[model samples]
Target chain A: METQKTHILRRLFFSTLYLSAFTFGGGYVIVTLLKNRFVDQYHWIDEDEMLDLVAIAQSAPGAIAVNGAIVVGYKLAGLTGVAVSVLGAVIPPMAILTVVSYCYDAFSTNPYIAAMLGGMRAGVGAVITSVVYDMGKNVVRAGDPVNVVIMILSFCISYFLNVNVVFIIIAVAVFGALRSVAAQKAGERS
Target chain B: MICLRLFLSFMQIGCFCFGGGYAAMPLIEEQVVTANHWLTMNAFSDLVTIAEMTPGPIAINAATFVGTQVAGPAGAVAATCGYIFPSCLFVTLLAYVYTRFRNLSLIQQTLASLRPAVVALIAKAGIGILIAAFFVNGTFSLAAGNVSFRMILYFAAALVLLRKAKLNPILVMVLCGAAEVIFYCAGTLIR
Candidate 1:
């Protein structure tokens, strides 16, 4: 029985390590990758649970990759599992970045390197575009004038107006919470 | 003192930045722009351009550039350390709580709502980049007024080649830079 427990712990820790090494696209990409690995590859979490996990992970903060790792870890091995997984994922990226920073000044001006980076900028633009395209459906809300207005207004404010994003997030959260409460109150009245 | 402050400010950014890197922008702007006043808005804008033009991530670039400015190399180290700490801490804490209520409905709903917002943030950043890259000094200026119909065609052709083929980004960058060099050399030869 103890051996079985140890084996499970090993599998969980190794899987987390595997993800950290391979994962890309950052943030939401983690949700998709982990869902496949956890639910399909490892058989640790079921499909329904995976969906819930994605939602919860998205709602929480920090890098999505780290959040997803924590959620997946906890599902697999309780608190200890969570600790191992999160650390497993976070350590590798941080370490790699640290090493790169040390060398950046030396390479920052190489024209060949600059050319590659110029290419990366365009590629990143495409990747970011794909992300926005996926999310456009959620904000537009099927031709609902109100949502359309909110988005356009938000864009204009964000773009032309130069309004800050933090204020917008707070406003949206407050309005949403209040609306939900009011809707619940109205239901009680009826 | 400046180096210490640079490190601590980014550390605070690392700690409090909850959503994603985009979410960190406000804190970054506040610290780099408002509190420390190390970078003017124009310089901040340029730093962002340089950041986007480089690799890794925007937050990382900001930390390095701002760090270098404040206290040279040591400042860069401090800022980088400060920037990544919150994520390391938050993810660690989250690992503990992710299991018991994994099936919570409210959590799922909130995530669904948040995903769209994440998309919005990305879009906002993209628009900002487009503005910054194409719009120079608060106006549109591309390759000096030499952007003829042919130049537009070249860009369109490049876009097509990219979308229709599995071309590598590094290769595409090389091809585009080569094209620019060729164009410049041709113009010089003409003169």
Candidate 2:
């Protein structure tokens, strides 16, 4: 039984480690990679649970990638799993950045590097736009008036009004709770 | 003392950086670029490119890069830990209670509401990044000029590759980066 636990822990760590080390473009890419590995490859989490985990991760504070790892890790092997998975997700980036930081001056001044970065920035921008489109399709329901309003309002406030995101989150959470209560009350009446 | 300060500042960022890494960009920009003066705006932009090109979360990568820029390796460790500290704590607590309260209607509704908001936040972040990348003058209006046609071309090409051809992100990045180098080197020679 103990051996089984250890084996799972090792697998969790290596898988996360592998994902973090190789995957670039960040955020949703990592989530998709995790889904492919855990849900499709390992069969650790099912399709439905993976979706729920992503939703929870998306709503929670911190990086979605880290949050996803935490949720899946906990589901698979409790606290220990969480620890190993977080470590796996974090270490590779930390190590890579540490090295890059050490040579930043060199990276900054090199014309070739500058051009490469210039191009990479555009590519990265495209990737981010793609994430927004993919996520917006799922999250924005034209059929659901409330969701549509919140989505549009949130974007306008953030982009146009330049409102602080913390305030927006607080307002939305309060609205959500109230909406929930109203929904339940309406259901009870029927 | 610097390490402690780094830890505290990043911990605050970690706590408040809701929605995810991209959404955290503005907050991070305010803290590191404007408030702390740890890095100039140009440097911060460069770091973002580096963060995207490299593996890991953008927030984590930013924390490490900014910390290292401000201090050193110890600073990197301090900042990285501080950034993730909230996540480790919150996710654990939430994970425990969430399993038991998974059926709670309030929780479900809260999540439902938050999802659209998260989408908006990500969209805002995406636009912010796009403006930063494509608009060389730092203004949203193209009439202000300084628009980089090359950047736009690259962006369109990459978007097409990803959306139409369904190419891998890594491949797109590599191809674009290489194309830029070749273009720039060739331009210099022709000039």
Candidate 3:
């Protein structure tokens, strides 16, 4: 049991490390990659569980990637898992920045680096669109009209209205909580 | 003392940075550039470019870079730990609560509702990045002149490869970068 636990921790560390090291375009992209790895590849977590983890990560303060690593880590092992995963997630950025700091001008001014980044951003955008499609499909699969409406409204409000995401999340969370309470009461009455 | 200051400053940014991603940029600019005077606006812009190009959250990259500029490697560690500390505490606590109460109907319903909203948020973020990727100067314009054909090709090709070929996303990203380098070299040769 002890060895097995250690092995799982090691795997968790390296998985997050590799994901963090390669994932570009920030939190959403990394979260999408995490879902792919954990749900599709490793099968450690189910689709529903991954969605819940993402919601929590998004609603939380700080980098969603770090918050994501923490929750996924906790789910897999516990607090110790959280520590290892967070360490792995952070190591790449710190190491890269440390090196970049030493040669700031050369690193930042290089046209080749800029061109590569431009292309990667395009690729990153594609990956994010795929994530939206997959996650949106799951929401639509539930056949909840209200949820479908909410999804559409949420997208329009955020994308078109340019509202702060924190407010949107808070609004949806309250509506969800109130909905759950109402359903509970209705069930009791029935 | 400087390390302590860096830790505290980043801790404050971490505590207040909700929604992550670009949301933290203004707060960071205010703290590191405006209040602390750690970096000039020009240097901070460079930092932003570096953060965007690099493979981590902008907040983490910013913390590490600013910390390194202010002090050294120790400063980087201190600032990073401070930045991530709140996330660790909050996520661990939330995860514990979530796992413990997952079977509860209220938790389940709330999660069910949250699922759609989260998807919307992801969609919105994706569109924002897509515009940034496909348009010139990261602005949306209908003009053909404003469209970046090369970036559009990269986007379309990547989407096809990911959805059809099921290629590893990291590998796709590297391929796009390599393709861009080749294109750049070819363009220079033609000129």
Candidate 4:
């Protein structure tokens, strides 16, 4: 059992490090890649578990990718798992960005870097679109019209009106809590 | 003292930022750019661009860059730890409660409703990034001289490869970057 625990920690660390190093764009994109690796490849987490972790990660404060990593890590191997996972998730960004900081002036002026980034940005946009679609399909397929409505309203509020996201999250969360209470009462009555 | 302030301010940003990393942008902008004046608006924008181009969470990258700029490597570590501290603490607590109470109806219903909202936020964020990438000067300009059609083509190709071919994301990004370099080099040759 002791050896097994250490082995799990090592595996979790390396996998997360690999994921964090390669993933570009946003947290949602990393979530997708993680599903492929952890769920599909490693069997460390199943589909529904992965989905739940992601939802929690999104709703929680801080970076979704790291939040997801920590939760999944904790589930797999407890506190040690969380520590290793966070370290793995963090090291790549800190190390790479710190190096980039040293050559910041040269990087900003390089035309080749500029061109590469331009294409990558557009590609990143498209990748994000794919993530949104996959996530939306899961939500919409659950057959909740209220959820569908909230999804549309949230988009309209944020995209068109430029509302602060914190307000949107608070409003949605309040609605969710209220709906839960209402459902509880209805269930008791029935 | 500056390091202490940096850590505390980032902790505040970390606590309130929801809907994922991109959503943290405005909060980081408010704290670093407006409140602290650590970086100017132009520099912040550049930081975002660089953050996007690099791997890892944009917020983490921003924290590192801003922290490094303000103090040094130590500042970077302090700011990052401060930023992620809430997440580490809260998520661990949540995992404990959620696993135990997952079957409770109230918890179930709340998660059900929250799922769609999370999806919406992701969609909205994606569209925002897309608009930033594809639009220029508040206009949807796709002209050859203005926005690079090659980039759009690259975007379309990437989408196809990802969805149809099921290519790895890292590979897709590399291919896009390589294609852009080739295209730019060719353009220069022709000119």
The lDDT for every candidate, in the order shown, is 0.57, 0.81, 0.81, 0.78
Tell how far residue A188 is off in model 1, in angstroms: 6.0
TM-score of model 4's chain A = 0.64
Model 3 stretches with alpha carbons more than 4 Å out: A1-89, A100-105, B1-83, B92-105
Q: Tens digit of lDDT per residue, candidate 4, span A50-105?
A: 88777667656889889988988998999999999999999999998888777776
lDDT of 3 at A120: 76
Q: Which docking class does model 3 fall in? A: acceptable
TM-score of chain A of each: 0.79, 0.76, 0.58, 0.64
Model 4, global lDDT? 0.78
Residue ranges of candidate 2 with Cα displaced over 4 Å: A1-8, A25-59, A72-78, A137-142, B17-21, B99-101, B137-145
Q: For residues A70-155, could you state the per-residue lDDT of candidate 2 as single tens digits? A: 88889899999999999999999899898998888898799999888777777877877887788788765457888988989998
Give lDDT tens digits, candidate 3, residues B12-39: 7786566567656655765786679998
Pairs of residues at least 3 apart in sequence or in different chains that clash in candidate 1: none
How many residue pairs clash in each candidate at the backbone level? 0, 0, 0, 0
Q: Per-residue lDDT tens digits of candidate 2, residues B45-132?
A: 6787788678888889998998898889899989988988988888777767667776445666776787688678777766666676
What TM-score does each model's chain B reach against the true chain B? 0.63, 0.81, 0.59, 0.66
Clashing pairs in 4: none
TM-score for all models, in order of appearance: 0.69, 0.84, 0.66, 0.73
lDDT of 4 at B145: 56
Runs with alpha carbons beyond 4 Å of true place in candidate 4: A1-59, A68-89, B1-13, B16-58, B69-71, B95-108, B136-147
Tens digit per residue, CA lDDT, model 1, A40-159: 987878998787666555555445666677677766666677767765665455455445545555644665544343333333444344446545765675554544555565556665
Best by DockQ: 2
Predictions' DockQ, in order: 0.23, 0.58, 0.45, 0.48
Candidate 3 global CA lDDT score: 0.81
